[model samples]
Target: MSAPLLQVNGLVKRFGGLVAVNGVDFSVAQGEIVGLLGPNGSGKTTVINLISGALPPTAGSVALQGQALTGLPAFRVARAGVARTFQLVRVLGSMDCVENVQAGLAFGTQNLPQRASRAQALKLLERVGMADFAHTTASELTYINQKRLELARALALRPRLLLLDEWLSGLNPSELVDGIALLRSLREEGITMLMVEHVMEAIRALCDRCVIMNAGSRIADGPPAAALAEPAVVRAYLGDDDA
Candidate 1:
């Protein structure tokens, strides 16, 4: 069999005396949507940071398609075909929707020219259901629209691996439905994703497999139902009595 598209081996992170992530290991295959699930402070986001080059790992390694990505700066990682969205929506605020995505296109791996970048940015905005808001300043958008805008920017990178850090949180039921559908569509378009999310509904709907973390370490990895049902996962989310 061919190798996985992304390989993370023995990943570790430290902040002073705190071990935010400990020897966490997982992989994302080509054209797969894998959910990274855990309770608050379970080190899910830390793992994302480690992989995305937002934070250098204290140990272990990250490789993309056999190319070592460990120790690269975040920009280098992006140029290497990895893009990510933050848990807190990040946008150019000063720039309008189209320009925000255009920024991504310009800096992304493709680095399209001015006219082409704008054209591609608009298409991406439309894909994320923000066509009408193409000229709207990012700061003026509602929370959900900002999320959409962030996603559009990430797509501008034309990444092989997309890391979504709670990109679907804070949505109502209706918005959640739309969010899940949008992600499913992206998966169909062949974007491999590793998402850190607490939304069980989206996890079950979008993930082919899940890697569950607890207190900075991986406790389970398997299909959503099977992984989430693991005794250790259950205990991590619920106390011993509940487990």
Candidate 2:
């Protein structure tokens, strides 16, 4: 593969006496939908927080498209071709759905006028299948549609790389199926994707490669079939078989 689109070398994060993330290295190459999976408290979200600049790294470096992003503010990091959707959906409760999307469109942009257009917001919502609820408030939307709205917001930046964090945290069987399909579609549209997911089935279906982390460090990395079945991964997350 050519050079990675995002390179995280020896990444570390510390909080006072606690070491939230240890020296971990990982990379996402161009056009790949990579899955980051682990048990709870395994530092998956912390890694996203570090990459998005929500928290500064205590050690190591993060490079995006061959450009270093050391100590840059979260908004600045986001403006630099990286966008992320949180596991928690945050929409303006008072505003209509389109307006909530408009808000995400303005996220990490210098020219708000260009991103906050009705046509563009509609297109974004349509892409995520939330166009029918475009006129409803955040509080009025069903839980599934709210999640879809958040996805539309993330795509508003025309991001080169999108980080999806727990996007399928809560959903019915149908919702999970549709959500996975929609996320897979982003790759077809030429968007590189990195996802932190819990659903084994979803990750297995959507990701071309999988990286497993444990205790703030890399335990395995390979294609989903190869990586997930690794003894270390199965032992650490999936639990080992009895002797």
Candidate 3:
């Protein structure tokens, strides 16, 4: 088979004496959505930070279509076709929605012209259900709308691989349903994704596979149902007796 779209091998991270991520390995195939599953403080976000260049690894490497991304700065990694959202919502609070997405298009891989970027930004906002708020300032948006704006901006990067860190968190039931549908649509449009998520419904609806981590190490990797059913994953999420 062709190489996986994104490959992460033996990924590790450390802060002085603390090992935030411990030798995790996983890959996301082109056109696939892989869920990164783990409870809070399980190193899932640390993995995302390492892969996206927000943090340098203590060891291991990350590659995109066989090109090394290890040690590159975040912008360079982004220019290499990887785009990500943070666990906490991040937006250009002072900018209007369209301008915020336009900023992404301006700084992303292609660096489109202003007019073209503006047009594409509107399209991205519409795709994420924010077209009506194009002129609204991001700071004024509700929390979920701000999340949608972030997604739109990330889409503005036109990335081949997307890393989403809890992008589905804090949504109500109906919004969660829409969020899953939106993610599925993005996958259908050919964006490979590795998402760190706790919402079981979204995972079941959107993931083609899952990689479960616990206390900085991987404990399961397989189809979502099978992986989540693994004894290690059960123990990590619940307790020893539950497993």
Error of 3 at 12 (Å): 1.0
Model 1 bad stretches (over 4 Å): none
TM-score of each: 0.98, 0.94, 0.98
Q: Cα deviation in Å at residue 21, candidate 2?
A: 1.0
lDDT of 2 by residue, 173-237 (tens): 99899988888788989999999998888988889899899888889999999998888888886
List candidate 2 segments past 4 Å from native: 108-116, 238-243
Could you give me the TM-score of model 3 versus the true structure? 0.98
Candidate with more favorable, higher lDDT: 1 or 2: 1
Better of 1 and 2 by TM-score: 1
- lDDT scores of the candidates, listed in order: 0.94, 0.86, 0.92
